[model samples]
Target: MATSEQMEAYSQFWSLTLGFAAPFALKAAVKLDIFNIVSKFSSEQGATLDEIIQELRIKHDADSIQAERLFRLLRFLVFKKVLALNGARYGLTPMSRLLVSHGSSSDVFVGGILSFCTSEVTQRSWQHVDAAIKRPGDSNAFVEAHGMEPQDYVAAHPEFWKVIEDFRLSISTATSATITRVYDGFKSVKRLVDVGGDTGSFLAQIVRLYPHIQAVNFDLPRVIANAPAYPGVENVPGDAMDFVPPGDGIFLKSFLHMFADADAAKIVKNCHSALESDGKIIICDMVMDEGKELHLQLDMMFLSGSQRYQRTKAGWKNLLESCGFGSVRFFEADPFSITEAIKN
Candidate 1:
């Protein structure tokens, strides 16, 4: 006979092993369009299993067994707190709402990110994690699995790029909301330049908040070609590595983290050269916190997929200070952190 503590420890180990089931279940829910259907009904009233099945367009004859399976899925989601149980019906929880497409209360939707993570290409890369670790700096799991770097892979597969672009936009949308709320340093900025501003989504939000500022949405030529025109914003196609357009305020969101220290420092130096005297460079990227499981997980993903890795607070400070920046300040935010550094 085993002690209760021993049994409990064994149970926890098994639970950890089967943790992949939750995300796969959520992916299935997204594929089946379950959350969107549940959103049609009020959370108080919720949606019955029968109603969900009907919305899903399942044949009536298969309902006996299929409905039971569907119920189990919803029940598991509720257990995970991705959904709420209202009497016998199911309702969307805050997490589930982020999976929904159009009817979500918040502007940010994470369904694309979820889809990209669970996609075949990404899943295959995860399978080679052990090999990636063994090889360390020499091999990337994504390249080992896909035969190319992520950018090259995305370039070859337009569909994957679309999913990636959507994921990028979702992140920008979420980060922009937090930035506009917490930081008011943009008030003094007369000219704003957004480096790697994909589709002008991030710059558009900033322009909306501070209409007085002249904004330049700077990105690659291919990226600029796809960007829609925004009022009081210019979409400039160029390479930031070579040169960045001059601006009093330069914004680099989710950009620097994609490079190693040498390349990142070069980019920072380029921004420094482009800035007017006493100008600022604002960076929104992950600052690794050892205590946060999410940060650790993301750092691992970065390590496995590319040459990039998340920086610690000290890493960010050193990079900025070495690149001719003064008065570096950090702001806390979910998913990503903000760092404001004024050019010396």
Candidate 2:
């Protein structure tokens, strides 16, 4: 007979296998708009199973099988802490509210993120990861599965880009508070440009914080054309590769790490040209350390061979210096590092 310790270890291994289904369930909950329903209808005691089923358009059957399935999903979600259970009722938890369209996290669109991640195209690419690794050179799993490069694939599918942009917006929202609190360089700059800034959220935050600074939200033509009007920020439509708007301070947040060295170099050089001799370039992105597992994992998830693409502290200094910046400095920022370089 197996020892209790051995049996427990085996049970944990099997439990992890069930983790794969969690995403799908979460996606279903989002699709059903369960969070909104609960938030809208539930009293302080919470929404009962019957109330939830009625809101869901699910009929309460005599046998209660379908109702039980829905109840099981809710029960599992409550176990996952996405919902709080009070007797037979369910209520929204903080994590679940992020999926709501009008909650505090409304801007992040976590439901959209879940929908995109669970979509067939994205999930299919994940299945080919092994094949991508086995290929000889620079093979992306997405390309292997979809027959086009990741950028090309995203371009062909507008929905994918929407998801990508939403993901970027979410990250920006999460990091913006810390950045505004810690970074003091924004005060002196006369004009600041946010390259590849989507929807002008970051730029909006900056202008709101420092009204003296004239902020420009610069991005692809399509992106800027659709950008919502932000007070005190000008929306400029252009390509970061071709040209960046001239400004005293250029800010790139979570932008450069997606590319390999060559493409990143091109963008860096463009920023160099767009800035005056006294201008400063501030890069808020991952500076990967060899020993940091979480950072390394994030790097891989964003780009293959992230070990080569994600810069170390020294790597960042060298890249900026080569691009004509006189000096470079790095500061620790959670989930990212702030790299500042100034021209001579």
> TM-score for all predictions?
0.93, 0.80
Give all candidates' CA lDDT scores.
0.87, 0.79
Please give the TM-score that candidate 2 achieves against the real structure.
0.80
Q: Per-residue alpha-carbon lDDT of model 2 for 91-116, expressed as tens digits? A: 87778877777645344445655665
**Where in model 2 is the C-alpha error above 4 Å?**
1-9, 41-44, 58-65, 86-89, 103-108, 159-162, 172-178, 181-185, 225-229, 289-297, 303-308, 312-314, 321-337
**Candidate 1 least-lDDT 10 residues:** 57-66
RMSD of each: 2.3, 4.0
lDDT tens digits by residue: candidate 1, 26-94: 999988888888988987898988898898875233434477888889989999999999788898888
